[model samples]
Target: MRKVLLPTIIFIATILLVIRLFYLQVIDDTLKLKSDNNAIKINYDYPERGYIYDRNGNLLVANQPSYDIMVIPKDVKEIDTSEFCTLLKITKEDFLKKIAKAKVYSPRLPSVFLSQLNKKEYAAFQEIERKFAGFYIQKRSLRDYQVPCGANVFGFITQVNDKIISKNKYYNSGDLIGRQGVEESYEEILRGIKGVKYIQKDKYNREIGSYKEGRFDTIAVQGKDINLTLDAELQKYGEELMINKRGGIVAIEPKTGEILALVTAPSYDPAILVGRQRSKNYTMLYHDSIAKPLYDRGLLAQYPPGSPFKILTGLVALQVKAIDENTSIICNHGFSFAPGRFMRCHCHGGVIQLHRGIYESCNTFFSTSYMRTLDKFSDPSVGVDVWSKHLKTFGLGEFMGYDLPTGRKGNIPTSKTYNKVYKGWRWSSKTIVSNAIGQGEVLMTPMQLANMMATVANRGFYFTPHIVRKIKGQIIDKKFTTKHKTTINRRYFETMISGLFDVYNFGTAHGLNVDGIDICGKTGTAENFTKVDGKRVQLKDHSIFVAFAPKDNPKIAIAILVENGGFGATIAGPIASLMIEKYIKHKITRKDLETRILAKDLQPEYNRFISKPIRDTLINTKVTIKEKAVVTIKDTSGIKKRTALKP
Candidate 1:
């Protein structure tokens, strides 16, 4: 019995070993992967990035071949450093630093030693390709801008950093990443999946096909193309008009909430930030505090909405039943919420209704309406909150959730905001009356201002503003398609629209009317102030304008802000008119306005603003800071000085 048991155990053990060997060799394939790891070399095949096109199918950005010098530190062999440095047009110190960085990143993994090599540089390096043991050339696709404009819209590509590598497992050391604009907003969709291959080395040192006979290899899937809502012609025209001016212009389609034209003045050619020159050009743009070409003023720069904010004030008043179309507030050149606290108005003294108030931009009428809105409520805090909530439906007071990466949540004050400011004091609507005419604590981006007009044009609802119009073979996010209705009723917009229409016909922007287009607009002169040597001083007013054309079923809604450009009717108004005419008619009948804008150079104003020397503030003496820090700063008599404790 013992001998029979021993024979049976041996036979069972032999059968189990055979079954396991068969599973590992054929059915499992796990050991095959591990077996190839030591003898196989892996390589990646990167695909071409998706092309960028405008709504009209005009190509905006395409791809160009780029080369990166990659190194695997572990595979490096001692060679003549002098010859290698000369071949790559790099100094010895640069080479050493790059190699050290690569080693620190990973000794076995590949890292970018020198990247974005030009054609000339690539040709020079090809001669010494054989001498370099660890290094190899990697081909990549870099952005080649079809047009010179829209740097802010197209954005740019750059290499991944250590921070990014640690967060995203898919990205290695040498991979490129998108930075801003459409490039950044849709990076995952635009950057297609990269394919990889593995080649095995036989014991005889001969190269063989990949594991599983190339079945494991994948074909690169090209990135999906996208269409932007931007009208190339309109974008180009707006940018040309903004030459020498420091400002932001945002235009949107009222019906769809599609961004038509986004212009940031003092911009650079997108081509400059491509290829090998990207780093140097970016550094220059970053340091230029005056123009700030890299800054997206349309989305980032926040300023007081000025008179255009009266539109929201009027809408909220009507929604809360504080004021009606027939609501009249008499103006005696200005308004007085409290004695000695006079709110000045340019309107002549008379019975001012909502229509006359908007066109004339009468401070008294709107301030009264604003006060009535809060005064109707039991608590000023609750009333102010209600008023603020009404405005937010117009896409103000928060990030509008646009497709772009960078933006500011333009300030919209509520009960909480004032609660912090006044603490427990019993504050009245009069204390915050300055908010009625778009001044006070209210701030908005040019994009937000444009979106407000879009909401008005849509008759109290707005689709979230977006740059992407279509993604190939896929629908856009439902949020962009979803209509957001304002707290105000639809009936209120017509009355507001009528007042805005009259702004072109009989008011401040009368001179800015296009011949055929029934343009509706509001001109604004926001009081610009900043701190100089710790003293707040007023600079020349920032010119602001908001408009939507056709008066009914409006096609375009636009807002613009020109820093230190005085009256809105002068600079911002004309630019708005030109943009509207150019977009609707496809030609500029008002060539005179275009010529004046083209010839006008605000560089002198910019120079003077930038030329102000900023120095340390000393006690009992006058000190000067830069213009943005103080603008037209002359008075420092009451300014505070920072005094450090004596050592």
Candidate 2:
């Protein structure tokens, strides 16, 4: 019995020892594994990007599945160098360099070599994929721009760079990010949540099975879809009209302030920047300096509004109570500001009413009217400040706050600006006389000018101009959709509108008038300078026209700028009229006028055109007599990229 008890005690001691050993080996194993995993394994998921569409439900930008062949440098082993290179269609030296780059980037992270492979290439790689242990395909999506209407406005997407990642944690290496335009503005909405999936692997590093049957996996949510305000047809036509021309056109609904069509010349297919050939095409576009097709001239260009600016001057005079509809001023073909200085005007006028003055674009009347408005102010500086404020209400000297990301805050000088330049507030009435006639330091974007015309057409209010009408299923926010009021009085717009109608019917833009449509318009010829070898040279004048059709309940308010166009009445005026006529009547009527206008080739380009010094004492200077050319109608088949240079 004693011997049995001794044996039992030894067995109990043995059991106790085994239990302690189990605690150390089994329980601590998890802690050690955790530390090991912390050193090696890191996981990431891809996020889905947003979709884009036009107002009509036509897909503009979408996504297409793409694949990248990635490699884990350290994990790669037993790779048949020659065979692998042959399959990948790469040389041995190239493969080695790529592997070296992968090591430099990160060994644990997958490095990409062949991206956006075709279906055939992908299939061939998939068949032999198992042989390559550390190599795999990373599924991704690339932008597929179906239509390239708004290339600059829509922008593009590219892999996030280090700078972007440093700025925002939402992005990391290999993340897709918005590069410009709407994509940047609405990044929050367009960038969707990321999805994740995990699978257990064996000692050979082969994926065994799902960890928990996808229970812990998160599904990707699609990004919010965007709907634009662009009328696809009109945008297409507008682009066609501006073909070959170096200028831009902006048209908006006067009442809603919704941009109908915005066209910039030297445009290209936006789709060219997407898919397999993306990098190649992008490099080409980036280096093309002659066309600069990527530049968004519509929103970025800050040009003198020319005659289109007269609309604002008319509104300001009436709003300031400095002029009435019947207010009359005389013009002797020019405005005499001082003894030797004179502001030139186009032919025709002797004591004309305020309405007729605007119709004829009489510089003399505007100079006097502008002086009267300034004189009405209590102080000269105060008057300039007040005048600038009024202009701001019309969306000048500021951004239109359009949905588009690109825009310029055009210059509208205040008294402070003038004082900074010329020093002190001691300047007299003639100091800013040019502002009265839409000249001097004032500059406006085509978008701003278009909206201003819309404000005049709507009588008092305009909506914040936007290219997008909705995003996904949600309508564009109320802040931009709401109507915005200008500083001009409600009743003051009619006089301006009536005068514009007369301008189209009998004034400078008379060639633009249609038989049935009461087209309202005003023309401007702005003198600009060209410098050659540090010498100022006289260049051709810019032809500009602002117009709206039907005159009442206007549908389109448009601003047309033809780079270096000789005369507003001849070049810009006819082009604008053709667009209006095409939109309203669906055809061109005045073929003779259209043919003649198209035939008159504008000699110089915008960058080359210059303004000459006006003869201080010269009179009846034979004015380089321009003949009124006629347009000839033809089938609109090849009308795309028609070049009509407006000076």
Candidate 3:
């Protein structure tokens, strides 16, 4: 019986071993994958990125053929290193360093050695690529900008870093990723899936045939094309108007909340970030500390809203029934909230109503209204919180959740904010009276200001402003389409709208109104200040303006801010009017205004903050521009310095 049991156990063990072998060979493919890895070389086929078109179907960005030099460290064979380096226009040290980096990334995987070669360079490299055993040329596509504008909107692609590779499994060494703007926001949809082919290799590293007859191969899928809400003509025109200027301009469609033109001054050509010279050009643009061309002022720069803020003050007051359209406040050149403190006004001495208050930009009237609204509640903290809530309804103080990757949630101070500032001391509306005039801690981005204007146009609601109108074969996120209602009642906006309309009829912005267009606008001049060697010093004021055209059924809402441009009427107003006219009328009737703005150079005003030596060095440095209207600056010493001023 013991002998029979031993023989039976041995037979069972033999049967189990046979079953395991069958499973590994027929059912499970893990061992097959390992075997294939040893004898197969995988190559990726990158598909062309989808084209980008403006709302009017004008091509904004298209793909151009490019080549990347790829390396496989384990497959490298000794060759003429000098000839290879010369052919690729790289030094021997650089080649060695790239090979070392590729090895560190993965000795078996392909890594980009050099990327984005032009046609001429590609042709030259193709001739000598066969001489290098481990190196190969991979075809890819880079952005070919149809126009030179919208660098801030279009963004650029760059090689993924190690951190990115570690975070995202889809990316490998030398893969491209979007850096900012729309590209970064919609990277997944824009960068299509990469196809792969596995080629079998012999022990001598010679190509034998396709691995497993290409059963595991995949075909690349092209990226989905997108249509942006921008108007290419308007974007080009706005960029031209912003020549020699350093600021931001944002225009939104009131009804749709689609961003029309987002212009940032000192912007570079998008093409500069596409080719082999991208790193050098990007470094220059990045380190130009004075201009900060890489900074998206439209979505990032926060500043005091100035007079445009008065509109919100009036709206909040009206919503709380603290003030009405008929409510009048007298201006004796200013209002005295405290014994020795006074808030000054620019309006003529007289009794002013809400309508007149907006157009005249009456400091005394708005301050009094702000005080009355806050004083209505017994506790100033509760009142300030309520006021803050009202502002938040307008999408102020918080990130607007726009479809961009970069933005700032402009400050909207609450009761808690003031509590910290006052440090437990008793305070009232009088203590924060400067806030009544859009000064103090109230800050907003140009995009926020434009959205505020759009809210006013919608009479208490707004759609989240977005760049892409539609994605091919897909619906946009519902967040962009959802209506965001402000705290103010819809009826209250009419009074403010009437006041804004009068701004064009007889207020500060009257002089810059477009012919036959009922433009409702508010002008603002935020006092600029900065710390110069640890002392707060006053700088030239920043000009600001916000407006919506056609008044009733508004088509466009826009906000413009010009740093150190003096009064809002002087620079910001005219620029907004021109932009509005260009967009609505599709032609410029104010040739004189256009000519003056085109010729005006404010570099000297900017230079006061930056050292003269630095300014001199930057002068006469040529920056590439497209769509004509390029200026050959002899000296740009006076433009406002971004580093010299603080919000």
Candidate 4:
């Protein structure tokens, strides 16, 4: 019986082992595929990135062929290193370093050794690539800009860093990623899936045929193309008008909340960030601390919203029942808070109500109204918080959640904010009355100001402003479609709108109005000051203007800011008026205004504000002229890097 039991146990064990072998060989192929890796060479096929078109179907960005030289460290064979370096126009030290980096990344996987080779270089390399084992050419696409504008809107692509590679497993070494702007915001939708092919190789590492007849291979899916809401022609015109200026301009469609044109001065051509020259050109642009061309002032720079803020003050007062349309405040040329601490107004001494006060930009009137709104509550903190809530509903004092990658939470001083500054509830409505005139801790981005005007046009509601209108075969995110109602009731906006309309007809901006357009606008002149050698020094004022055209059913809402440009009417008003006319009329009838703007270069005014050493250095280096030439030529060849491949 013992002998029979031992034999039966052995038989059962043998049957179990046979079943396991059959299951592994037939059903589970994962281990088998790993074992077969030694005889299979994998190749990646990158798909063309999606194209970008303006709202009018004008192509803004398209793909151009680019080739990269990739290397597998484990497959490398000894060859003439000098000859290879000379062919690639790289030094032996660089070649060695790249090879070391590739080995560290992965001994068997491919890494980019030399990237962005031009057509001439590609032809030269193709003739001799067979001599270099372990290296192959991989095809990819780089952006080919159709226009020289919108550098801040259409950001560039760059190779992924170690941080990105670690965070996203989908990306490998030497992969390109969007850096900023629309490209960065929609990276996933723009960068298509990479297809992989497994080639069977012999024991000698020679390619023989496809592995398993390509059963495991994938087909690359092309990226979905996107249409931006921007008007390319208007954008170009705005950029042209803003030349030699330092500020930001944002235009939004009032009905849809689509950004029509976003222009930032001192911007470079988008092409400057493309190809192998990107790093060098980026360094040059980045080092220019004065201009800061990389900085998107439209979405990033926060400044005092100036008189455009007075409009909000009026609205908040009306919403809180602190003021009515017929409510009148007298201006003795200023509102005297204390014996010497008076908030001055440029409007001639007179009694004024809401509409005339707005058109005249009466500082006294707005300040008195602001005081009433804040003084309504016994505790100034409660009043300040209430006022802040009303302002935030207009998309001020916070990140507006626009589609851009960068923005500032412009300050809307709450009771809590002042508590930190004043250390208690020691402040009152009169103590912080400068806020009534858009001074004192209140700040806003140009985009936010434009959106505020859009909200006014929409009568207390706005869709989140976005650059993208649609993606081919896919709907845009629902956030852009949702309407955000402001804290003020819709009925209150009518009074504010009427006041704004009077700004064009009888206010400071009356002379700058377009002929056929019924424009509603506010002009602002913010007092500028800076520290020079640790002492406050007064500089030229910052000009600001915000407006919407065809007031009844507004089509375009825009905000323009010009640093050190004097009164709002001097520069920003004309620019805003021209921009509105360009978008609505599709042609500029004010050629005289256009010529004056084009002929004027405000570098001298900017120079006066800069420190002597930096100003002298800039002059000695001729950096401004070089930068201007860089924009005009759009030639990246002067940049020190491998030439990019052409399509």
lDDT of 2 by residue, 1-647 (tens): 99899999999999999998898787655444444442333344565678887767887788887777888887899978898889878899998898898788777666676677767888889999888867888777778777647766678887776687779876655677777778888877887877756565567665666544554557777788887777666676666655556567888877777777788765666766666677766665565343456667788877877767767777787788888888988889998998899888874969877787877788888888788888898877887887888889888898778887788989998888878877844786697788776678999877887887788888888899988778766767787768778888888888788888888777777656777888888787777666787889767777777888778889888887766776777677787787777767777897876676655544235323222321111122221111111011121344321111122
Q: Lowest-scoring 10 consecutive residues by lDDT in candidate 3?
A: 626-635
In model 1, what is the error at residue 427, expressed in angstroms?
A: 1.0
| Cα error, candidate 1, residue 231 (Å) | 0.6
Candidate models: Cα lDDT each: 0.85, 0.73, 0.87, 0.87
Candidate 3 regions exceeding 4 Å error are: 1-25, 28-31, 619-647
How are the candidates ranked when ordered by TM-score, highest leading? 3, 4, 1, 2
- In candidate 1, position 356 carries an lDDT of 92
The CA lDDT at 88 in model 1 is 75
Error of 2 at 619 (Å): 42
Q: With candidate 4 superimposed using the best TM-score fit, by how many Å does residue 422's alpha carbon deviate from the native?
A: 1.6
| Candidate 1 off by > 4 Å | 1-38, 202-206, 609-647
For candidate 1, the lDDT comes to 0.85
User: What lDDT is reached at residue 292 by model 2?
Assistant: 55
RMSD of 1: 7.5
The per-residue C-alpha lDDT of model 2 at residue 416 equals 81
Model 3 clash pairs?
603-637, 603-638, 603-639, 604-638, 605-638, 606-638, 606-639, 606-640
TM-score-best of 2 and 4: 4
